[model samples]
Target chain A: MILTVTLNAALDVTYRVARLHQGASTRVLSVAERAGGKGINVSRVLHTLGVDTTVTGLVGGLTGRSLRQDLALAALPEALVTIGQESRRTVAVFDEAAGETSMLLEPGAQVTGDEWRAFTARYAGLLPSAKAVVLSGSLPPGVPVDAYASLLRLARGCGVPAVLDTEGEPLLAALPARPALIKPNADELVATTGLTDPLAAIEQLRARGARTVVASLGAEGLVAVTPEGRWRARPPHRVAGNPTGAGDAAVAALAVGLANGAPWQSVLARAVALSAASVAAPLAGSYDAVLYQRLRDQVAVGPFTQL
Target chain B: MILTVTLNAALDVTYRVARLHQGASTRVLSVAERAGGKGINVSRVLHTLGVDTTVTGLVGGLTGRSLRQDLALAALPEALVTIGQESRRTVAVFDEAAGETSMLLEPGAQVTGDEWRAFTARYAGLLPSAKAVVLSGSLPPGVPVDAYASLLRLARGCGVPAVLDTEGEPLLAALPARPALIKPNADELVATTGLTDPLAAIEQLRARGARTVVASLGAEGLVAVTPEGRWRARPPHRVAGNPTGAGDAAVAALAVGLANGAPWQSVLARAVALSAASVAAPLAGSYDAVLYQRLRDQVAVGPFTQL
Candidate 1:
């Protein structure tokens, strides 16, 4: 089973409007609520794909209770550590007329020292049962920048493969701990390695001790480097929709492939197909099973050499 | 006792920030939550002034639960009609640097037919005990625009004075019901009467069967036209602070004066003083007792000719 961690979880509230005008009152057509955080997204996608996954994170107060309730309604397995302060809420205003999206993110609840220690102990206890652990999303207030690195070390101590999918300082700090896989989008790769070229950034990531590096190039598809070989995979047809959780879907596919001992080339192709299918689906982190299977067969996987 | 009704109540969340920039993420320095709605604001100010007040409104789900809990925490007496859907939440972002406020209002939960019947029955049951009733705030979704007019008719049937504080079509519809008093800010007064001049607007409102019309002109104080007399009351000093709930504070003072048997002129002066004191307080609809007393003595009341 895959274990996912989200240090700063949030209750995401989405409002559908005909259009959004700044500094003007709007009447929403509909509203939806869900649990949100990178790891939660990854676990949700994996669960949709019939993969066994458990999500662990810090949650608190009423908002946190709402988050957990939503996850339960979705039938997603989760183990959230409770805290004193309420979890933050993220508002996504979707404008159907303009085909535009605006976001207002609340800074999540602050985590206390005792809460952090409790999460660490719980994660450690679950590491033995977990085949692979994925650490994702932002560090809440009061958490150190090196928190991810510490978690990476803990996973390694238990001989579990760790997949790290975060950006900025947390990603940079965890790279030296040699996680099995690190997936960074183009912009995040550039920010972390200070390299404009994606291939060069992948090389830099590998040099920093990541066993394997996957770079998602949005519409262009996936570029990955593994110990056995390097491969580039792309979908035969582009399926356009909201691309909100496509990357999380890709990470879920990759973890599923690695745990099943799939070859690097096949794993890269599966990840690309799953991601494209996610964009084609109406909801985030969800894909049509038939479309995913058909796209997986049509995905083009070829050898690639770093310049 | 004064009864305040908020058909579409909300949990008002305010975030204080150094500055606000469009299309950029902002971190709030401080956060505050309060039970809010036009009628709720009026009740809060009345309670602060040691007036006997009971708040009645529709509240539902978790957000509604939070609103009720907060009111109890504030030591305010309330009689809430519970509904099925959750109450709404309003976000107010305060940019201290620019001294500007931006608001994002949520369309509150839909009110069902049965819910409306229950609420009206509950409201009617409480009317005989109230000396005056206040109907304020916007109508929630699924509620008719003429809701306030219906409630006003109920108040008249009970022989209790009713104060209407609202805007747009709701206020326009309520005028024909001949409420005891209607307090409309300068903009709302102009909108309802289609007259730019304050005196003319008040005349239009009075002609529509309203027994009394009180027009609030922010820093200029208040103008009132009653059966007894027409008068203007001005604050002795300008207090620099938030003016968000000053109008509601003025309406609360007006209710208190009428309940205490104060003359029309004294009621107008007390309204101005209470509003100014609210401006000096940190929270909206809250007045410093000491400041209010001092300002009450200094309020200038005089006869004024219609412009």
Candidate 2:
């Protein structure tokens, strides 16, 4: 079973309208909401893929109730820890005419030192039973920057592979704890490692105590460097669709592969395929199973021979 | 005691942001929410004025719970009927830099016939305890067009005066039932009666089932034609601000005045004063008590002689 943690879970709401005008009332044609956050999305995808996953995080207030209700309605596994602060609502306004989506993200939860202690205590109890632990998304307010680092250490102590998918300081801080695998998108990769070359960037990450590094290059595909080998994987053709959740889908695939002890080449192929399939699907945490199967067969994984 | 019915209540949310850009992620600085609807706003103001007011309407599901929670937190009075459907959320994104507000209104609830029956049964039970009844806002889906008309008849049967505030077909349909009073803004007047002349339009309304007619002229003032007399009242100076809830404020004053059995001139003066005070305040369902006092003393109410 995979355990995913999303400290800043949100109720993701989408409003569909013909067009959005500035400073004018927009009558939403339709409204849809889902439980969302990075690790929650990961857990949802893994659950959809028939994997045993449990999602644990802080949820509170009325919006928290709504998010929990959404998770229950979807029958996705959850073990949310309650807090005092209300959870956030992330709004996406979709314009049908222009085919554009504008988003408004509420600030993350403000977990106090005591709440963090409570969360850590709960997390410690669950780490032992997990095959892998994936810590995803940004650290909420009041949570220390070293949060992911401590979690990774605990997972390592339990002999659970810790997959870290984040960016900036938190990712930087967690690397020294030696997360089993780190997945950074092309932009996040450059931003964090400051190296233009993917291989050099992965090398820098490894030097920072990362065991394995996987970088997502958007429509381009996946690049990885591991102890066994280094490989590059690409989709036969780019799927031109919303790529918002493609990276998360790749992370889910990677975590799934790591749990199953799959080879690097096979893991890269699955990551590239599932991610492209995610882009094909409209929803963020979902993919077309048929498209995924076809893309899995079509994705090419080869040795990283380029400089 | 007064009774206010909001057939389509909502959880009104306001988001404060530095700016809003199309197709971009906006970080909201703050969020505030409350229970809202036309009659709900009236009930709130009435409660603030120490009037014994019970707000009755349809409320259900998560959004309804949020609205009810807000009302409870505010300690406002309510007796909302529960349904299987969830209530709506009306969001106003306030751009602090430009001082402009963009609203996104969720579609109204699709109430079932059984739900409407339930609401009517509840409304019938509450009518006898009220000094007056206010039926406000649009009729939700699956509710009959004659919903207000039926309610007005029930109020009249219970010897209670009914104040009707709405637009188009509902207003037209309710006129023959002769609600004790009907309040329409200038635009609603033009749309419903197709007459630019406020006095003539109001007279037409009085001729159709409204015992008394009051028309709100934005920035200009208010016009009233009651059997006792006809009067027009204006604020000493226009209060320039977002007029989003100005009309609702005027309705609150009107409901308060009618419940007190104030004379036409006094009611018109109070409505004009309170409406301008509402324009000065940032939120709807709120007025500047000091400004209301000052304006109440200074407002000029005189006989209306049409051009």
Candidate 3:
């Protein structure tokens, strides 16, 4: 079973309104809430892909309770550490007429020193039984910036793939720990390495100690520089829809493939297909299966070339 | 203790962000949540005024749990009925840059038939201990349009002042039940009675069996045509601020006044002063104590005019 860690889990509340009239009250046409975080999104895709996965992170207060309840529907087992502060909530307001969404994301509650230590201990305890570990999302306040690096160390000690999906200081700090796979989107890659060239950035990341670097190029699809083989994958056609969860879908496919020891081309194909399918789907962590089945074989995978 | 019933209560979540940009993700700088509903707002104001108040209605699931925790901080005792559905959540996005707010209100979860009966039974049980009972806010789904009428009947049967604070059909249905006082804003009065003149609209309400009619006129304060006498009251000077909770402050003062059998002039003066004080404060259910004290004596409370 794969283990996913989402330190800043949220109760993702989405509201559909007739129109978004700024500075005025709008009667919501409908509201849908679910448990969400980068890791949870990956876990959702993994579960749908038929991989056994468990989610563990910090869960606290009533928001945490609601999140856990939301997760119950997904049938996820949690070994989450309880904290004194409540977990945060994320609001997405969808305007039906305009077909737009404005998101408000809370920074999340501060984690105490004890809570961070408790999470580390729990992470270590859960590491041994997992085929892979995926550390995702931003670090909450008071957490050491090197938190994911510590988790990567535990995963390495247990001899399984440790996937890191985060940005900024956390990504910079975790690189030296040499996580098995680090999926940084084009923007995150530029922000971290200060280089516009994705291939050059991947080499820089490897030199800094990441075992493998997979860069998500948005509509252009994915480029990877792994130890075994360098590859590039692309969808047959661009799907015009939300790109929010596309990266998480790719991460899920890659994590599942790494755990199962799939061929590099097959893993890249699956990730590209799933990412495109997720983009066509209406909400995050959801994909169009019929579209996935059709696109899975259509993704073009070839040897990577210098950009 | 004053008893306030919030049939359709909410967890009012307020987020402060730098600027609200449509169709983009915003990082919320701060978040504050509180128990909210028209009746609960009244209860909050009464509690702040050092009046003992008990808050009751329907509360369930994790949102309810969070609301109850928030109420605990206010030292409120609950006689709330249990329900299977989670309570509603209201999001208020405050744009610090533009100094404006956009509110998203969910219609609230559907209340089961059993939950309605259970709430009425619980509301009745608390009626005996309350000096006065306030039935406020809109009816949630699955509740009858005449819910407040039933609550007014219960309060009448118990011989306590039943204050009705709502609009539309709920207010229309409760008129014949003769709640001790019904507070409707000028627009609500116009909508319900179809009369343009406040005095004529109030007379139509009295004709329909209402005992007293207190119409809130926003910056003009309030006008009451009661059995004791008729009075119009306004603050010494208009306080320019948020008017969100001004009506609720008036309701709280009126609830206290009716319970104590205060003279008409005394009740009008208190409400006008508190309402203005509340408007001057940053949040609803909170008032400027110094403003309230000074305005209490300075408010002009006298006979109503034809204007």
Most DockQ-accurate candidate = 3
Off by over 4 Å in 3: none
DockQ, candidate 3, comes to: 0.87
| Clash counts for the predictions, in order | 0, 1, 0
| lDDT, candidate 2, A50-164, per-residue tens | 9999999999888899899888887887888888899999999998888889898888868889999999999999988899999998988999998999999999899999899
lDDT of 3 at A44: 88
**By lDDT, is 1 or 3 better?**
3
lDDT by residue (B1-307, candidate 2, tens digit) is 8899999899998989999877989998898888989988887777766778888899889899989988888788789999888899988899989988898989988999889988899899998788898889998777898888999999999999888999999899988888998889988999999998877888889988799888888888988888888888989998987686788778878887877888878888888988899888877788788989999989999996782
Tell me candidate 1's interface RMSD: 2.8
Comparing only chain B with the true structure, the TM-scores of all models are 0.96, 0.96, 0.97
CA shift of A161, model 3, Å: 1.9
Give the per-residue lDDT digits (tens) of candidate 1, residues A204-241.
88998899998898978999888988888988977888
Query: Best lDDT goes to which candidate?
Result: 3
Quote the lDDT for A44 in model 2.
77
Best by TM-score: 2
Candidate 3, residues B183-267, lDDT tens digits: the string is: 9999988998888887898888888878988889998989998988788888889899999999999999999998998898998
RMSD of 1: 2.7
